[model samples]
Target: MQTIVYQIKDAVYANLTNRCPCACTFCLRAKGPGVYGSPPLWLEREPAQAEIDAALDAQDWTRYRELVFCGYGEPTERLDALLAAAARRKALDPALRVRVNTNGLSDLVNGRPTAALFVGKVDCISISLNTDDPDEYLALCRPKFGPAAFPALLRFAREAAQAVPEVVLTVVGEPVTDLAKQTRCRALAESLGATLRVRPFENGTRRFPVP
Candidate 1:
């Protein structure tokens, strides 16, 4: 069976699609079928809007503080479905916060400036900054967009800050991203009106903290 929605800590996660433009070297999907011992996230097929809504409806709203659009792939790969789910969640319970964990390539993926679409649909958006160097990002992430990806990602973050309530850019801690690099990333995030979060890297997987 496909796992559409699952819980991690106080958040309920929505698994939308397995499509992503970049293939990062430290991607968790390469290490295992799941993250933090959840069910296999590789969807047999992308869930439709109805299926996604049904999954959301089934969840006990009182238990989860946030709804996150994140799974084995980039959430923006299915931008429409993601936004629809977030909108529905907000309509059902306005207090329940909604977030999207993304690679910041939505514009390239959808062929337009997509950050403005978030507006009031999502409460927060966490983007992976990875590194401060463009060459390093190209090497580490291996995005299909080649040299254009990094610039687009930065632009997206800048736009997202204006659209979303909380915009965060994250980098892995220690070995993956050193202290000096993390500091630069923090500065970069702040320049774009976003905060930086240094996620802990453990057992080859980035541990995402609950929002």
Candidate 2:
């Protein structure tokens, strides 16, 4: 018998595509989306909006805590798909916790302000703010928008909270494991009314391995 084992807890991670705007070296998809334990998350193609909606239709929405828009890549890379799915989820239940995990490059990818799309549709947005410094951010995130990504990301986090109800920022929690960076990152989150999350990094476990 085959069972599903997911990395994310209590929530369903909607992997819309393997495509992304940033080329973070630490991304899991750099390898592939598969089950190390059970169930299987494999991306054959970027599913269409209709396909995504139908798939969700098969699930028990009430049992899940959140519907996370994430894959091996940036969820916002397929902005329309995300919006459509969110609309459907909200239609199912207005109080459903809808979230989008992004690299904070939707504006650059879409050629316009994109946060407004989340208004009343997305409840929480989690962005990858790997560093507080532009240089470090660029070096790590490799954003397609250049150094401007740092400020833009900060600004996006601010707007996301206002557009929806909650905004969140996350770091790898290992690469920038220092008090200075943590304080600055937390301060930025505070200023934006967003929650700051420090997810565990596996230097000896996952991020870096014997090579």
Q: Judging by lDDT against the true structure, name the best candidate.
A: 1
Candidate 2 local lDDT, 38-127, one digit each (tens): 244556666777778877777776677888777556778889988988898889888778888888788877878889888888888888
* C-alpha lDDT values of all predictions: 0.90, 0.73
Clashing pairs in model 1, backbone N/Cα/C closer than 3 A: none
Query: What residue pairs are clashing in model 2?
Result: 3-39, 4-39, 5-38
| TM-score, model 1 to reference | 0.96
- On TM-score, the candidate that comes out on top is 1
Q: Number of backbone collisions per candidate, in order?
A: 0, 3
lDDT of 1 by residue, 31-139 (tens): 7778876889999999999999999999998888999999889999999999988988898899999999999999999999999999989999999998999999999
Task: Write down the worst ten-residue block by lDDT for model 1.
Answer: 202-211
Instruction: Tell me the spans in candidate 2 whose CA falls farther than 4 Å from its real position.
Output: 1-8, 35-42, 203-205, 208-211
lDDT of 1 at 80: 94
